[model samples]
Target: MANTTSAKKATRKIARRTEVNKSRRSRVRGFIRKVEEAIASGDQALAQAALKAAQPELMRAATKGVLHANTASRKVSRLASRVKSLSA
Candidate 1:
């Protein structure tokens, strides 16, 4: 129960932010899934392309505070490595 006017306003703001964050998180996940699917399909070219596309999205999520910077970097690194291995 938000008794004060300010508290009520903050609650509304939080709800709005939560929705936005959820969308961003989902989008990031979708990008990662695309890369993984490409990798799983054993298409090096598609996996490379997917990883290329996902890198920016992951970084954007990190910059926007949806994910930690290192976390995003780690994901990109791991995915890139896996994609690269498909070349060998």
Candidate 2:
């Protein structure tokens, strides 16, 4: 119940932003999942390649405000470690 016109417009803007954020979040998750799947498959080359692709996407999401910078960096670090261990 947005009583004012400005409130109504703000509500619409929030809804639009929510949808955009959801899409961005889902895209970031997909990239992370690809890396995880590659690691699970025990393909070091594949995991490395996937991480290469995912790192930028994760950082982009952070820049877009969909993820925290530290969170993205941590995810990248953990995934890189797992990928590295695949060769061990």
Candidate 3:
């Protein structure tokens, strides 16, 4: 499908970028899932720690354009609130 040399190069670049982005997305989700699993296990301390670790990963994904900044912030806020409420 990529007839021109430039187009073929572009396609290759896209494939590489797609793989990188997919890895990044999966890593971010793994961090979030750790927080969720900690929360589900009802370990307040563990949940807090997982959320702490996830915050930066979420923000990093946002900065890399994998997620919107607002979405990352909202997720951090919600997770923090839930972690906090676990103490109550």
Clashing pairs in 1: none
User: Over the stretch 1-88, how does candidate 1's per-residue lDDT look in tens digits?
Assistant: 9999999999999999999999999999999999999999999999999999999999999999999999999999999999999989
After TM-score superposition, the amount by which residue 42's alpha carbon in candidate 2 deviates from its true location, in angstroms, is: 0.4
Name the 10 consecutive residues with the lowest summed lDDT in model 2.
39-48
Clashing pairs in 3: none
**lDDT of the structure predicted as candidate 1:** 0.97
Flag regions of model 2 displaced more than 4 Å.
none
Q: Score candidate 1 by TM-score against the native.
A: 0.98
Q: Pick the candidate with the highest TM-score.
A: 1
Model 3 lDDT on a 0 to 1 scale: 0.94
- How many steric clashes does model 1 contain? 0
Can you give the lDDT of residue 45 in candidate 1?
92
Backbone clashes for every candidate come to 0, 0, 0
1-88 per-residue lDDT for model 2 (tens digits): 9999999999999999999999999999999999999999999999999999999999999999999999999999999999999998
lDDT of 1 at 35: 98
How accurate locally is residue 59 in candidate 3, as Cα lDDT from 0 to 100?
Answer: 98
Using all chains and alpha carbons, the TM-scores for the candidates as numbered come to 0.98, 0.97, 0.95
Q: What's model 2's lDDT at 30?
A: 97
